[model samples]
Target: MISRIAETGHAVGTAVGYRNLSKKGQRTVKAGLLLSPVLLWLVLYKYLALGYNVYLSFSEMSYTGEFSFVGLANWQQLANDPVFFQSLFNTVVLFATIPVSIAIALGIAILLNQQFPGNNAFRSLFFLPYITMMVAIAVIWQYMFKTDGGVINYFLLQLGVIESNISWFGDSTWALVAIFAIQVWKTVGFYIVILLAGLQTIPEQVYQVAKIDGATRLQRFLYLTLPLLKSTIGVCMLVGIVISFRLFDLILVLTNGGPGNGTEILLTWIYKQAFLHGNFGYAAALSVVMIALAVVVALIGRNLQRSSHL
Candidate 1:
């Protein structure tokens, strides 16, 4: 009888262990199933494309879609291309609006943070541009910037700001500026939204303490708000750099990199080279340069932020 009881107990133990092992195997399979799609997408779409682009940059891609490795010939050509330097300079100059946009956004955020009538309405209005269609915005601005019978030029003429209607997109001096202004107009709202959210995260108690110490509003803002908002500002600045540096659509719609390439940016130049000029290898090299610029901008922003914090 004791032998029989021991045999039954061993059988129960073995069955329980097998059941647990089966459950573990099922969980492992489930996890793999969930992650497989995302891993496959990243590998094929992102990593594979990036590798192919690098390969193309080193090869001569012909109009017939044939390619052969030319051992840095594309890179050498890119180095000597005058348009590349002009586009790089324009790319750098476009970044000038980032600080201006952030500053304006921060100001608006501060104003919106105050207790006032129609505060939510104001916020929604400011953020409307960000949610609106980019193409629609561009079209509306294009009309407004028309050389004749345009609302903007009409107002300028009315105010004696200019002698006559000026072609905002035709002239080299104003073409880049017009694009810059449109970029700021479209993007300022996004930064404002980010900053407003950050501002709300600050504890009211901090302000209360400062008030108790009899600090003036400007003094409190300078001493506390700016310092505390550094992280948020840093994030906005980095993102703004990336967005403004890769500016293409606005220039495409407004100027098409025209007025003698006055408003040409890196991406637009790359588009022109790849599609119009049928120089895919050169475009790939330009893309590599763009990636390098982005990395350098990110690094420089980080270092500047660290130094400021220290």
Candidate 2:
């Protein structure tokens, strides 16, 4: 009788364990089923597309959909292409806006962090440009930077900043400057908002303690604020780098890489090669280069962020 009872108890315990395991397996399957659609979409649209693009970089495709494996011909062409180097240089130059925008945004954010009348209104006003359509902003800026009767030129003339009207978009020298100015104006507001949030994360008691220690405002900002805000600044730098690289639409609407491709960056040049010039293989190679550069920059940024924390 004792042996029978023990056997019965063992059987019931095994059954309970099996039931629990079966339920766990079922839940796992359900979760996978729920996530399968999104996973499939990403596989098809992102990873597969990326792999195909890499393949295309090694192959040539004509305008009439004629495809042929060209091996490294496109890359060799890219190595000898002056326009590719020029676009690379131009893209590097666009990074100049990152530091300038960060400085301006940080300054504004600091000022706005203090208690002041109409502070929220000022923030909203500054952030207005960020919410506006990029193409619309580009169009408005194009008109403002017009050679004749533009608001900017008129103001410059009135203030004796320039002796004559300047062709902002038409001139190679000033076209890039115009692009930089518009980019900074459009992005600074967003940076300001981001920096403001970073600033708020810092406890007010820290500032009070600094003041008690006889620290001047500038000293406190330099020694206290900047050190604590390092991570936030790193985030801003990475964001700025990404934004600078994705400047195709703004450049397209503003200069169309005009003034004899003077303002041409990687994306604009890629668009021209693939769509206008029908050199899809070469364009794909350029894209690969751009992606590699972006990855390198992002990795560097990540390392820097990690080092700051250390």
Candidate 3:
């Protein structure tokens, strides 16, 4: 009787273990089912598109959609192209706005962090440019910067800042300057919002303790606040780099890369090559180079952030 009872108990224990395993297997199937759509989308859209672009960089594609593999010819042409280098240089020049934007945004964010009247309203006002349609911004700024009857030129003439109306979009040098100004104006609000979020993450108690320890405002800001916010600043710089590199619509609408390709950037150049000139392979090579540069910069930024934390 004791032997029989032990066998039955063992069978019951085995069945229970099997049921637990079956339930776990079902849960795993459910999880996989939930994730399958996202995985499929990435596979179809992101990875496949990226792979096709890479392949296209090595192959020549005619305006008639005929594809012929011509390895290294497009890349060789890109290396010898002066316009490519010019566009690259123009793109690099826009990077200057990143530091300026960061500095202005940091100051504004700090000021807004302090308790004051209408602080939220001010933030919303500043952020308006970021959300505003780029086409509208381009149209408005293009009109404002006009040499004749333009609001900016009109004001400058009235204030005796210039002897005559400046050719903002007409002159190459001044056109780049105008683009820089617009870029900074449009991006500063975004940086301010990001920095404000980072600032809030810092504890009030820490600031109070620093005060008790006789830390001056500047000292606390430099040593405590900056160090704590290093990660956030790194993130902003990375984002700024990407934004500066991807600049296309504003340049396209505002200047159309006119006055002699002065405001032309990598993207605009690529667009012209692919659509206007029908040099799709060369354009693909240019795109690949741009992607590589972006990846390298992002890696460097990540390393710097990691080092700062260390």
User: Over the stretch 146-247, how does candidate 1's per-residue lDDT look in tens digits?
Assistant: 999999999999999999889888887788788788888988998998889889988999999999999999998898888777777877878887667435
Candidate 2 lDDT, 62-145, residue by residue in tens: 878889999999999999998899898888788778878989999999999999999999999999988898889888988999
Worst 10 residues of 1 by lDDT: 301-310
State TM-scores per candidate: 0.82, 0.85, 0.85
lDDT of 2: 0.88
Error of 3 at 68 (Å): 0.9
Tens-digit lDDT track for model 3 on 1-310? 9999999999999778657777778688678889999999999998897788889999999878899999999999998998899888887788778878988999999999999999999999999998887778989999999888999999999899999989998888899999999999999999999999989999999899999999999999998888887877878889988677535889998989978887888889999999999999999998887887767767765765775642
Give Cα-based local distance difference scores for all models: 0.84, 0.88, 0.87
State each candidate's clash count: 0, 0, 0
What are the runs in model 1 whose C-alpha is more than 4 Å off? 1-40, 300-310
Sort order, lDDT high to low: 2, 3, 1
Lowest summed lDDT across 10 adjacent residues in model 3 is found at: 301-310
lDDT of 3 at 128: 95
Q: Residue 181 lDDT in model 3?
A: 91
